[model samples]
Target: MNKNKSEHTKDDNYLKHVSQIDQVNFLNFRRYLIDWYETVKRDLPWRKNQDPYKVWVSEIMLQQTQVDTVIPYFDRFIKQFPTPAALANAEEDQVLKAWEGLGYYSRARNLHAAVKEVAASYGGQVPVDKEELKSLKGIGPYTLGAIMSIAYNQPEPAVDGNVMRVLSRVFIIEEDIKKVKTRHIFEALVRRLIDQKRPSDFNQGLMELGALICKPTKPLCEECPLQSICLAHQQKIETTLPVKSKAKKQKKLNYYVAVIESPEGKILIEKRPSEGLLANLYQFPMIEQTKTDCSLLSEYLSAEYDTNLNQEQMLEPVKHVFSHLIWSIDAVKFMAQASFIPKEHQRWVDKKELGDLAFPVPHQKVLRQI
Candidate 1:
């Protein structure tokens, strides 16, 4: 009985907090945001249409990537995979090739898999219903809400980091935004504040406000449409309201890269394992070290390639940071003996052929230098 009472009281408190937002105030909030969005939204390619396939591709590209970076890639990808059927029919390498340099290769793989299902099952049209949309692989709550609201104009709330930041500042929510529980609170608030008539505009407006005005630091509170009613701004604590815990330190690793060029001037590249980091991407052969060192490269080349490799030059170290790991790569140029043979997953390619193969950004950088 005591436990039930405690749970009920907690739910009551949550409801009470949300109830503080009156109907009139909520309407005014929505009105101001929609009005502001109409005047000042970014002229994005995806925003020009209500096509769900375009929206889905743009959203996936925008995950952990910036808008400016996504625009060209989105354009090129759509041109290549104009429909679900196009992506479904295309080879995996072709899909990854289109998505090269975007990072998070898994998103590309999942999108490919999901689009194949969409082509076969949904007849190349993105599903309209929320539950059906959720059933697709890689389509989570946020993506589902975004597609439903933006493309379908449903009264679904697209609560991403931008939306969370905007709401946390507007409501003066002091809860840690990093916690999974906190997202539910923000989602509920969005449900209350979402404009029924223009769900797409309203959701986009909130995200736009966060991206342009209610920023992480030195927020342009004066420019925000919600400035008048924003709790954080009203309390003069806008910069400090949406508190998020810092992420864990990335594990540092050292990789000694071997750029082996055969006597005929073709470079040796290998395909990464089908699983794990940089899966199925092409790169020069490499040996990881406990710390930054180049002595192991000679021995590794002899044992792995069964050839004597003369290290021509040791270039400057290159750093590539992922979400959870930092790669400190030392690229070494080596000349493979003429008798060297290409092993499994390894092939010799000229510069033109290298361009055709999809190499991760770090490898691309080193290739340019070599």
Candidate 2:
């Protein structure tokens, strides 16, 4: 299903039940959700203030990524690109490098592209309205709703997985959660429930409820404040409220790197092809294999760099994990020749300059020794 562009869809008949919702009960649930939020919410830095830039960055990074994984990356990225203008004006390669290991390189690329336009056209201020926000690259319905409600105090609903799960259970929605129709139906329900007085707190509070209390597995139902109103909770069907298909397993790869170095302090690194995994990133010259060793590593480079690589110069094996692939790399060091040719795709840099350049995760690890 090509769910690439999700317009602010309005399914009137689908959400007819929402118009008749009991406001008093919804407000009680809202208060309970917010009360739970104040004490139990995760101590994320972005939540500390009401900056659109910070909230936008956090939302962008948190897409399809775990909260714990994004926390450190978010901290580091905000330290580097503190504002919309900072990120908007920065180099794309630098942004992607900073976004390394987070996966989904396109998010970083599209974000950079969109903000460049924002800086030029919108004076670098993130747009407040959902329509304006949607015009930017990579900013979809959820992102727009998030920025609108959380950053700008708009009374819109951000229907993410967590919120969907919680809402589906509260009203006992039985439709397939994977379908866009199901989510839109729920969003209309929450949109009217949003306390126009405190939309930010209300929306984030529901998100908070789902994340901490009504989790996907082994929900702390005892701690949930919406126990009285949640139909799933009363019926003991909370786990099955938001039904969806199983996730597809990511394919795995066993990649190896040959980190070769020369005697005079220069190191051999190659730029990855301009497409596919880790595209446009730097890596140590590599030898692809199902399995490998020092002997194979030496022979692989015989014609390319030099066979003068000493066995003692070789560092121990190193490994890195991407979502699908497992990369295993062995570092091999060499004594330099007086004059060696650099290939079109390869570069020989002063080893000390590795830090200055953006090496991918695996190459960055090999740099500690080589």
Candidate 3:
């Protein structure tokens, strides 16, 4: 593409970290990273497979989720679904059940949708090209890059938070990583340095480097291969490399989460609206945070339904943390003599079956305590 001066300048903006990185330096970093990865990379199950579907699933699941947490789920999910056709054939409820307690239910929902599309459109094979993969819903640039390189051996770059953190620190980038410009810049840097032949190794190497060596907290500088040329280490500010805007404050709200039980041992649960947070998951009947007593809960239940809340014994309050909110929940367990009624949003599930349906993570924590 031919470019005018202005266009060239705009494109040049993508190399803000070049002052600290060049062919020699990045190659050095890459060598060290690949070496460290060959030796120290954790034996993740997904790493053992080249199936694009499994790779995509693992990548999506690992988003903002811990490796320890994802390991078991990955194992079970592969066992349950095995292939794109199987996942696509399953019902939404079954898929959600498989993805229970993973917290971000949308990933599973989107995976289901994408699978159906792939089955119908691509003969159930996940596309290998970055552009084709990106065309699928919920597959963004980072995910597409991951899918391409990790599963297809394409030299595409996946500039996730971990990659961004690792690169920004390696090259002493000062731009706020939260910005779109930063993503473009860092992605370009990754593309420049990525080993064309062994891209899967390159992308995973970046992630592993960030996770273990270039951590946000006290980074292990001595053990790092880039130590000699690291500007952050020399500045004694390795802890503060990769500067970015502060995190948005999490919204705080009070909730009265009901663990209401009937005399028949049926627990009152509800299905959250299938649009927002954990939309397709099961949950306890809850009220927005407000000042409430036993009378308040009793009165509220009586006003809303056919089966009334009978007795009141509230459980200890639990605080549930989300990416953008903190729910201070009061688990109110009520013993009511109510039969099944199709209310606006409540379902009385049996105690036995409740274990199968995946409730949101924090709700499970409350269930464990109460």
Candidate 4:
């Protein structure tokens, strides 16, 4: 027997239970979910209109970010770049400034690229065709599904973590949701169960239900609309149904961040390379080391910039954790001994100009030491 086939067969057995729910119960499930959504859905800005641009922006910002944090950012971003044309016309630095605090810079970068394409090729309108939408950078399966169903009223499934949790509980699925195959399984189930007439509401309802009721911990089962039909709830295993494998441990790296101020009251900062971690963002001059060593920072400054650290003082360390890496930063403060010629990627900016330039969260913490 094929190992992959055996695993698929195991998953199919769980799906069979879902298919056995019959048309009438599926209708009831949809009715219960959509009715509850319409009644209690939170007043979010993106929900106000089915404008594909707004939906796309909100979806990208919301990924790996909380709604409460994204709301203000979304509001500010929309106000700044009201249309695809507006965003496409703006400078990358300006776009990054608007997205300053949002952790995932690549999302903003890719969205900017995609919006530029939208303005140039699609006449500032997000493409409606699935194939056309998929061609755009950062328009992954979940995002494509969201734009299609929520914006264009297509019957595509937006099966995110929330939807998976809700579905796994309702159908009592035991598959490890971390696997790619499990997502496909959930997508198939959604295609079958999704309300054709109100695909938008159906998709949003599942997401909302998972967020508010089918929570990862301490789910409010009594208040859930799907409680009547939830197999996991009936079996008293709602919390345990959505099985997910543990993520790999984040690798930790040490760095010495140098905060050097010139005699002219200009702060020295450098732009990260165009690609890789924290791409194209401004940060204090920093050097990665295997271990914490302040002397290495001095040597780096002398060699790289031909300047020595004067009035050197250690500042409070900053610890920033990314999805895959943890940065254990040792922040050092000093004044420039002499003005040296700045490199192409290095700049000396006054306080006001420094404030305007976008710095990633880690560098922002270092800046606070000044």
RMSD of each: 3.7, 4.4, 2.6, 4.0
- The lowest-lDDT stretch of 10 consecutive residues in candidate 4 is 15-24
Best by lDDT: 4
What is candidate 4's lDDT per residue for 214-281, written digit by digit as tens?
Answer: 89989999999989988888889887879999999999988888888888888888999999988999
Identify the superior model by lDDT, candidate 1 or candidate 3.
Answer: 1
What is the per-residue lDDT of model 1 for residues 1-370, given as tens digits with 9 covering 90 to 100? 6975875555555545443355237877988999999999999999898799999999999999999999999999999988889999999999989999999998999999999888888888898977778988899878989999999999887888999898887777788889877777777677767899899999999889888888888899878888888877887988886889999999998888888888889899999999999899999987877533467667677677787878889877799999999998989898877647788888888867888878898998897887
* Residue 214 in candidate 4, Cα distance off native in Å: 0.5
What TM-score number comes out for model 2?
0.83
Instruction: Output the worst ten-in-a-row residue range by lDDT, candidate 3.
Output: 2-11
Report the CA-based lDDT of candidate 1 relative to the real structure. 0.85
Off by over 4 Å in 4: 1-24
Q: Which ranges of candidate 1 are over 4 A from the true structure? A: 1-24, 291-293
TM-scores vs. true structure, each candidate:
0.93, 0.83, 0.92, 0.93
Looking at model 2, the pairs that clash are 263-336
Per-residue lDDT value at 54 in model 2: 90
User: Model 4: clashing residue pairs?
Assistant: none
Which is the better candidate, 1 or 2, if ranked by lDDT?
A: 1
Judged by whole-model lDDT over C-alpha atoms, candidate 4 comes out at 0.89
Q: lDDT values of the candidates?
A: 0.85, 0.77, 0.82, 0.89
